[model samples]
Target: MRRFNLKLYLIFILVLLVRISNAHQETIRVGFIESPPLIYNKDEKLVGALVDYLNDILPNFNIKFVKTPLSRVPDLLDKDVIQIFPMYFYSAERADKVHYIPTSFHALNPCLCALKENKIPSTIRDPKSFEQKTIVHLRGTLKNRDFLNFKNTNYLELPTQDYYEKSLKMLKLKRAEYAYFADFQQVKRFLNNKKHSNIHCENSHYPKDEMFFVTNKNFYLKKNLELKISKTSFKTYLKKHLSRVNWQVD
Candidate 1:
């Protein structure tokens, strides 16, 4: 009986050590972009709604965040250089490379901004009405697919400089009659500038798209995240975070 008791005690100690080692294992690296109020760097620290949400909910999870240019996220995910990415919408090409969490983390409302000096209509009610009207947008992006179908609208695609302010500046400069498509919050932030007061953003016409998290297919936390997010508090936290952007959770 004494020998049997000794073996059990050793087995228990070994199991406890193994569990502790696993618990303290290397932190998972999460990649994000500077889509503020969603995720962005401020004062050299990662700060934003998503950052706050993760901080609040994942106390037990070991996570290390990495901020990079939003443009590079796709390639980085493909190479599995980053284990996880947050707040991205589903695309067929992305789907091919990464596995998405089953639930949408939040939604975004993309809007169009036009300069008041140009007498551009406040809203784009009819696609056909865009004929001959010049629309400026960030180069390498074609987010407004429905509006693009009306090829009659002249496009002045501009290169991005890690921000959308330049695209709005072009509209202010009258380089284009209107600038089309950005997250409503981004447009609001741009127009808040005194110089951009001449710009009017049309929130009436926009697309409401759901955003999700993507991870390398082999990421260990992929399954665990699905479980964590299903909790009531997780969704409540998400709703609270998005509320800052005037987004409602259904």
Candidate 2:
């Protein structure tokens, strides 16, 4: 009688565990930002290229999401608070620690912005241009390697509290010689607006950079799911998202 009860108790525990797992079904959350035309914020809601992309593809993983500032992502992610990010450039150190699901490197066209009258050479042309220009950018991101060699690049890094809006203000007040950003319509909006005639994009950004996601590669649940989505499925998922975001791709 006692033996029979023990067997039944074990079965009960097994069933209970399974039930708990299914009930929780925690989703692998990813972090993204509000970069208009890429990731935009509206009404305390996030919507844009990255958001749309994830909305379509994330379902495949049975994961949930949380939109957050790019800087905050690392802290949450280091402890596996969240396991994903919409788009990130792969790095050797990150690759060793995080799993980069195969995806397009060149995800979008790039653009550079600066004051119109500030003839500092469109390209930065070379790193030396930084010495003559003040560069403002979203913190916690790698600046373009093209300008890395230049040590004299005067720079102003802002927190998310006042990123783009502050940048616009700086440019308008001629406080910054240049601000680096990549977006089609938003850059156009800034350039076309009468208030921003002094600031404009370079001829255009060249050697367009690529963007993709980074998964901790350490979380077992997310790892298995990410792997289950084959390369073909991943690419197809990405394409569908691109279409949804109205990004032009050949």
Candidate 3:
């Protein structure tokens, strides 16, 4: 009877241990920003290219998403409020704080989006061309810094307090004259549903850059997550997304 009681006690302890272990297992926190086609809010749900890709690949992994404005994403990473940002480009400053996944998910081709009626130069071969234009860009985003490279251009940055949709609206309403920069495909996708034929992307633009997954230095599951991402085929997902978009447009 003592042996039987001992066995039951041991089983109870094992069960408690298992529960504790389960409780302590970290749930990966992936940071999301409002970049249309890549990530955006729809009907209060996170939905976009990156979201769909993550849903397909991370079903078996434990994950929680934190969605915020594009500008705040960098701050959240700096504060370690989030563990992972699904897509990021490398820079010496940013590289110091985060570990970049070895694989690149996509190439980002950013361009100037302006109203066709404005007759904005389709090609931007000469930096001198945009001398006095009231260029508008999303505040605190990659574009803000990118535009600074054009020393000859004077650009006005939109308030970060506002949303990206507002920037598009401003362009549509001709509130800003030119130089609203964004990913060409993303801008095209955004314009598809809108009633604007005047909006078009400039042929000449910033050089293409690759985007990769990046995680904070202290994230617990960093090693395992990076391993899985390395094994995954990013092009497969990109192809699928493109096909879907083409079919929908057709």
Candidate 4:
């Protein structure tokens, strides 16, 4: 009788443990900023290359995406509002706020774009070349430190709503002489629109930079998430997804 009772007690504990584990895996909140082809809303559904990749790789976890502006991402992560940010460029400043998965999923090449009629130089070997030039970019995406090399250059920052296209339009309208973009591939994709045909981007002079998945510092599953991301062929998946949207992966 005592043996039967002990067996039932053990079974109950096992069931409870399993329930707890399942609960923990049920939902993981992921934060995203609206960057087309990477992450965006379409037809009332969250869909994009980064979204598809995360959904495919994390089949076991129920993901809830929280869309926020780029500037608020660090605060959201620090406050534990989200467990993961599926795609982000690495910076020492960001690293202090969140932990990055050691493996990089993609590479980006930064470039300067301007209307062909503007006749900006094709390559920028020296920052002085842009002296007194007016540049536009998405606010919070680029900083004065990024342009520490270029003194006296005018910077016009715009909000993130359709930023890529808007930045190009600003150049076409002569509001800015150049548009600085962090990802050459993203700029290339946007340039496919006939309206932007006159815009030409300078060849990237900087070495390719890698982007990684980042998690809140306090996230409990950071190690497991890192191992999963490191083991997956994320680059291949990203390339395939981007290609579907006519965006090249580099």
Task: Give me the candidate number with maximum lDDT.
Answer: 4
How high is the lDDT of residue 231 in model 1?
A: 58
Q: What is the C-alpha local distance difference test score of each model?
A: 0.67, 0.59, 0.66, 0.75
Candidate 2, residue 239: how far the Cα is off, in Å: 11
Off by over 4 Å in 3: 1-25, 69-75, 119-125, 143-146, 149-152, 159-165, 238-250
Judging by lDDT, tell me the better candidate of 2 and 4: 4
Residue 220 of model 1: what lDDT?
74
lDDT of 1 by residue, 31-75 (tens): 865565566555566656777777655666677887644566767
Tell me the alpha-carbon RMSD of every candidate: 8.0, 8.8, 6.6, 7.2
Over 1-250, each residue of candidate 2 has an lDDT whose tens digit, in order, gives: 9999999999999999988876776566767665554555555555554555555555444455566666565566777767887566656655665667675433544555666676646564577656766777667554545664477767777765546567667877888877656544445654454356666676353555567666665656454435443332334433443333322111
What is candidate 3's local distance difference test score? 0.66
Q: Which regions of candidate 4 deviate over 4 angstroms?
A: 1-25, 121-125, 144-149, 246-250
Off by over 4 Å in 2: 1-25, 60-64, 67-75, 193-195, 203-205, 220-250
Worst 10 residues of 2 by lDDT: 241-250
Model 4 per-residue lDDT tens digits across residues 1-88: 9999999999999999988887887788898877767776666777777887887778888889997666777788888788788767
> Per-residue lDDT of 1-250 in model 3, one digit per residue for the tens?
9999999999999999988876775576788655655665556666667876776666655567886455565678768777788867777777776778777777877777777776766455566666666677766545425446677676666753333456667777766777554466656765675545777776454677678888767666667666777777666666555534321110
Per-model TM-score, in order, reads 0.71, 0.69, 0.72, 0.80
